[model samples]
Target: MPAFGLMPISYRAIGVAVLLAIVAGGAAALSWHIQDWRYGRQLADLAKTQAEALNQLTLAAANQQRAEQDKRLALEQRLQASDQTYSKALSDAQRDQGRLRDRLATADLRLSVLVDPSDADAGSGVSAASGAGGMVHGTVRARLEPAHAQRIIGITDAGDRGLIALQACQAYVRALAR
Candidate 1:
């Protein structure tokens, strides 16, 4: 009743199938390990490059900051020097002004005497012979030397600038009278 050319399953064929499956599993595992190693190397290279870039950036930033600090310091030094110069100039100007004021006062006193030599003697007639040219302490002379008289006359010509006011004149007159 069995059909010709029909065969039953063998244990040897099952063993060959199992062997093939094992070989395929080994190949797949090898491929996965290789891919993992390649990816790891790529990641390592990327990290190294990033680290280098960060270091460069940090160095550049430090340099920039130092340069800016130096500029600020230079500006501050210039400002300090300018302040010192300004202070010195102000002091010099003030000194010059004081000198000018003293000169003006002396000129005014000289003019006051010229405009009214009588005012110099006032009611007392003290013979303000505190004489004409410079100052004469004693003895009235019959006449003044031409040059001394000219010098006294010159004081009046400072033209209004050196002349004392009427009030100032009266004050001087009073002071003289005293």
Candidate 2:
């Protein structure tokens, strides 16, 4: 007897075993391919979402910048208008001040003539006649009566009140004459 306990191996069994191994490997490869495809799709979707978010953020930032610029421009325009108004006011004040100075000078001259008739320049055409005690223009009758002249002199003599008192005194004189 050759080998009583040993069983002989068959080629059919080996071929069947190899076929099963190939099928199992093919199944595993298909499963791995499907998993990779899903992972790639998920990554693409995440990228798309991130891109949309970035776009929205960019648009918001741009809008904010535009609003800031608009505000700055409006502020600048307001400042310019205020500056122009201030300049105009200053100009008007200066002009009024100049006119006031001129009036004050004329009033001072007239007052000087009235206070001292001897100091009156003949060419100035302002004179205080003897009995009138009031200023008389050359060849013209006295416009202020003696009482009005005295009252105006008293008002002016009281230490430098503003022009309002002088204006009031003149108005009073005019009303008395009327």
Q: Pick by lDDT: which candidate is best?
A: 2
Any runs in candidate 2 off by more than 4 Å, and if so which? 1-13, 106-178
Lowest lDDT block of 10, candidate 1: 158-167
Q: Candidate 1: deviation at residue 159, Å? A: 23
Candidate 2, residue 40: lDDT: 99
Give the per-residue Cα lDDT of candidate 2 at 134: 52
Cα lDDT tens digits for candidate 1, 21-131: 998998899999999999999999999999999999999999999999987786666656655655565555556545545555455322233224555345544344455
How much is 164 displaced in model 2, in angstroms?
22
